[model samples]
Target: MNHSPDTGTFQVIHAYTRAEAIGDGVLVDVTDTAREAGYLLPVAMTSAAWAEAVAWDETNRALQDEAGRLWDVLWMARPAAARTGFGQTRIAFDVLRVPNHPAATEPHRVTLHVHIGPGDDGHAVLTVLLAHED
Candidate 1:
């Protein structure tokens, strides 16, 4: 429940929190590894983003690993975040990802969008999702 000056007090019917999302696997927590990449704030990736951009398997294992792919995503995000206005709420970045598709022969570029918004407790959190996701 919350109060507002313009509107009367109202109760939140329901809410889905960042923690819940992570627990449910809708979001994948990458805060620890993100810290290794220099991110100080909480970081998560949408499940779709994970499946499409970061998930790696034995099909591509001979050439890559999950850690390396995750690192690449963060490494690319850094400069995109830096070049954007500090006050901006959303940042867009691209990564040249090697397809996990067994028959693919080259890396393909994909755009990932980073959204900075209030989490369940109101602390700002970052979410990396596909460009088409919210």
Candidate 2:
């Protein structure tokens, strides 16, 4: 089956993280922030085959594979504040997928934007953007 690039769409799954206050009582310790962040963000891909897989709840498998391969690159690319928890941290993101004339090998691209500090409830908010390419 042939899928049109313009038919693709992006979706945001959820946002989550594991964080602990630092010893200095000034920051928090977030281990494996990238992995955690990745999990929080939804998966995106440009493949009719992959999209079909996702419809059947098989997207996790694809995400696992991609994450395994790109974890290092994504993790290292994370912002400094995200690496070291200072105050309450929040990563807010919006996932978008747009069809192109010819789909690229990596159809899905995750654009992540983070926010640090406590919310009104005095809790950390991690914002994530999940985009899937059609």
Off by over 4 Å in 1: 1-7, 83-87
Model 1 lDDT per residue over 27-124, tens place: 99999999999987788999999988889877654488789899999888877656544778788999998888777658899999888888888887
Model 2 stretches astray by more than 4 angstroms: 1-66, 69-77, 80-110, 117-121, 130-134
Compute each candidate's TM-score over C-alphas: 0.87, 0.27
Per-residue lDDT for 24 in model 1?
Answer: 100
- For model 1 the local lDDT of residue 37 reads 93
Candidate 1 residue pairs in clash (backbone atoms < 3 Å)? none
Note the Cα lDDT for every prediction shown. 0.85, 0.35
lDDT of 2 by residue, 1-134 (tens): 34456867545464332222224322232335444755333222223312321122223322334333334323533553355365534343333322222332234544443444443355544322223310
Residue 36: error of model 1 in Å?
A: 0.7
lDDT for residue 105 in candidate 2, whole number 0-100: 29
